[model samples]
Target: MDVLTAIRGRRSIRSFKGDEIEPEKIEVLKDALVWAPSAGNLQSRFFYFVYNDDVKRRLVGAALGQGFILEAPLVVVGCADIRRIAVRYRERGVYLYCIEDLACSIQNMMLAAYSEGLGSVWVGAFHENEVAGILEMPENHRPLAIVPVGYPDEDPVPPERVAHKDTVKEVF
Candidate 1:
């Protein structure tokens, strides 16, 4: 699917089919992240693919029983390696800017998934520290978001958006 079509088709799928998502497709989704524009080309984002059932359950627990996480066959975690940023800006460390970079990359991956006829949901309501520890990430790497991917079993309509007149701002 084209960019605009994917953008309009992508939805926060809460129900997934029992079929398994192929690793090749998962790689395709991840490759989008590698090409995502990063801040100063730091390339500090790290992705973790969680396919194990037990681990998925742990993640759901960390997410306070958001069962859909465990239901999906694959979970992609978007993380930012803060230590890399700290190398150049020592005092500043990873900072919020790095988080934004990772988050944007995750969104790119989500869009890629949609183009491939897959469904994904961006999960931000979760325990970050617990996820970092579960993923065996270093102290400087922070978990930004979790995206569950698969063939959606249910089709829920996207909610209507506010008119552009109310949302767009002009600062002249």
Candidate 2:
């Protein structure tokens, strides 16, 4: 599917079929992460895929009872390596670009999954400390998003969107 098609069709999949994701699709998602734009090409973002059932359950707890996490066969945890950004661009980069970099990577992964006919949801409402603890993440890596990807069992109609004219303002 094209980028626009993917963007328009993608939905937050809260329910997923038990079917396993193909390794090829997983590789494409990984490539999407690596290829995503990052500040100064420093690539502060990191990702971890969780497949174990116990780990998925722990993640659901970390996500503050978002039990949908347990339904998917895989969860891609997006993280930001703030230390790397700080080394490259100091505190300002860490504060500004690190989170954005992580977010961009997640968007790319989500779109790529959609293009591959897989389903994914971008989950950011989780407790960061709890997630880090659950994943046993390194000290410098901060978790930003937990994306559960699989064959969608539920077809969610797109949520309402505000008209573009009202949402955007011209400065120049």
Candidate 3:
């Protein structure tokens, strides 16, 4: 699918089919993340690809109760190594930019999933420390989002978009 079509068609899919996702499609999503723009190209993002049923269950049980997480064969936990970014960009005010860069990487991954005919959702309302413990991430790594990817089982109607006249503004 084209970029614009993917962007418009993509939705936060919370339900997934039992079918497993192919390894090649997972690779495509990861490759897209690698190409995501990073602050100063530091590439502070790190991904923990979880496929084990037990670990995925733990993740679903603790941080997220979303059963789709367990149904999906692949769940990618996005993490940001702030210490690495801090080392490279010690200058003040750069930490926020590094975080923004991490967000960009996640967005790219989501869009790529949509383009590949897969479904995923950006899950942020979860316990970070619990997820870190489940994933066994280092102290310096911050869990940003949980993306459960698989074939869509349910279709969600598109939510209304904000009108340009009310949301956009121009200042000459």
Write down the lDDT of every candidate, Cα atoms only: 0.85, 0.92, 0.85
Candidate 1 regions exceeding 4 Å error are: 89-93
lDDT by residue (tens digit), candidate 2, 1-172:
7889988999999999999999998999999998989999999988989999999998998888999999999999999999999997998888889899998989999999988888999888889998999888899999999999999998998999999999999899
**Backbone clash pairs in model 3 (N, Cα, C under 3 Å; residues 3+ apart or in different chains), count:** 0
Clashing pairs in 1: none
C-alpha positional error of residue 28 in candidate 3 after TM-score superposition, expressed in Å: 0.3
Model 2 misplacement above 4 A? none
Rank by TM-score (best first): 2, 3, 1
Q: Please give, for residues 85-118, the per-residue lDDT of candidate 1 as tens digits.
A: 7677554547765776787788888899888878
| Total clashes for model 2 | 0
Score every model by TM-score. Answer: 0.93, 0.97, 0.93
The better-scoring model by lDDT among 2 and 3 is 2
Please count the clashing residue pairs in each candidate, in the order shown. 0, 0, 0
**For candidate 2, which ten residues in a row score worst on lDDT?**
87-96
Predicted candidate 3 versus true structure: per-residue lDDT over 1-172, tens digit per residue: 7889998999999888888888899899989889999877888879999999999898887665877788887898998877778886774424586678778988999999988888899878788999999988898888888899899888899999999989989889
Cα RMSD, model 2: 1.0
User: Pairing residues by index, what is the TM-score of model 1?
Assistant: 0.93
The model with the greatest TM-score is: 2
